[model samples]
Target: MYRRIRFFLTSVLFLCVATAFCNDKENPDAIIGTWLNATGKGHIQIYKQGNKYFGKLVWLKEPNDEQGNPKVDSKNPNASLKTKPLIGATILRDFVFDDDEWNSGRIYDPQNGKDYKCFLRLKDSKTLLVRGYVGVSLLGRTETWTRIN
Candidate 1:
């Protein structure tokens, strides 16, 4: 009876450890690569900055103005921000992963050069759901980003 009880306890302990390991969040290493805006409105590249992650605009479907001049984000009310357009802009900033989601981050919209609070979650191994919000998270937009690999 003593030997049977000991074996049962050992088996239970091993199962607990195995379950924890298997249910762990997606590996951070899996996120360390280029991803594209599969919606085709724009392209983004995510990279590491120290221990944080950031994403930048690499391409756009509409890269120019109606007159064929380089487009600018004229809608930005900030005088210092209105002059820059969709090129060479850092759109995603200060993203960190925890608890199976990326929180406490911001995404910049090159279309208006405005920054919004952002969060990211993996919908699948190859798809990410990027949420950008202005005030409350209840009022936000989610975009789908596809892994480039």
Candidate 2:
């Protein structure tokens, strides 16, 4: 009877520990938040739509032109988009979460009027690593983004 009781207690303890361990794992939606870009010039807000993730420039350090007008996507390749405001523009698109990383996305560069293949991974709960590549990942650039909220 004592042996059986000990075994039962041990099993309960093991189950409790296992459950805690599993629950402590990071959620796939943990990336949803406002993040400060590496240059500290812009703030990107990441959000989910359906099952995919996207990020947009929500704020900019220099949100105005020399004439003090609201900044627009002046460098956008599409002539129509060139007049679109940059603050609400979606810069990161179509990212899908997989194996602790977000991939299969495109990152739009308003400064250069270019789009590059991109991927994102969390360095921790508060830090994100973003990579944008042209042809291959090895030829890409990585930027560190910090959570803002």
Candidate 3:
């Protein structure tokens, strides 16, 4: 009787530990990949840094201006950042994962020179929903991004 009871408890403990290990391994980095923007004009690469996630503009359909110079953050309100190149710019910042969604981030719109509160959700393995809003989320816009692969 003693051996049977001990074995049962040990089996339960092992199952609990295994379940936790498996859950932790289940795609915590699922969003780490390059995604094409909704307009099909640009690509953003999302990567994890520490416990936070960030995204940067990796490519653009038109990387150069009419003068053949690389595109820059020309519309930026900050004069110091005006000359910063659009490609490789960190457009998404400080996103934390919570319950399968990324929240508490900011998305920078270089075209309008504005920043908005943002959240990212993966609708499927290939589709990501990006929402950027001001004041309230209902007033903002959501864009669908497709996985590059």
Top candidate, metric lDDT:
2
Q: What's the C-alpha lDDT at position 119 in model 3?
A: 93
**RMSD per model, one decimal:** 5.1, 4.0, 5.7
Better of 1 and 2 by lDDT: 2
Q: Which candidate, 1 or 3, has the higher lDDT?
A: 3
How would you encode candidate 2's per-residue C-alpha lDDT over 84-109 as one tens digit per residue? 99999999999998877999999999
Residue-by-residue lDDT tens digits, candidate 1, 1-149: 99999999999999999877654255654465667785677768888888788887777778888899777767766777677876666778898887788879998776565789999888776788889998899899998888876
lDDT of 2: 0.93
Q: Rank the candidates by lDDT, best first.
A: 2, 3, 1
After aligning candidate 3 to the native by TM-score, how far in Å is the CA of 120 from where it should be? Answer: 0.3
Candidate 2 stretches with Cα past 4 Å from truth are: 1-26
Deviation from native of the Cα of residue 58 in model 3, angstroms? 0.7
CA shift of 12, model 3, Å? 23
Q: Which residue pairs collide in model 3, if any?
A: none
- Most TM-score-accurate candidate: 2
Candidate 1 lDDT score at position 82 = 71
Instruction: Assess each prediction's global lDDT (C-alpha) against the native.
Output: 0.78, 0.93, 0.92
Decide which is better by TM-score, 2 or 3: 2
Structure candidate 2, residue pairs in collision: none
| 67 Cα displacement, candidate 3 (Å) | 0.6
lDDT for model 1 comes to: 0.78
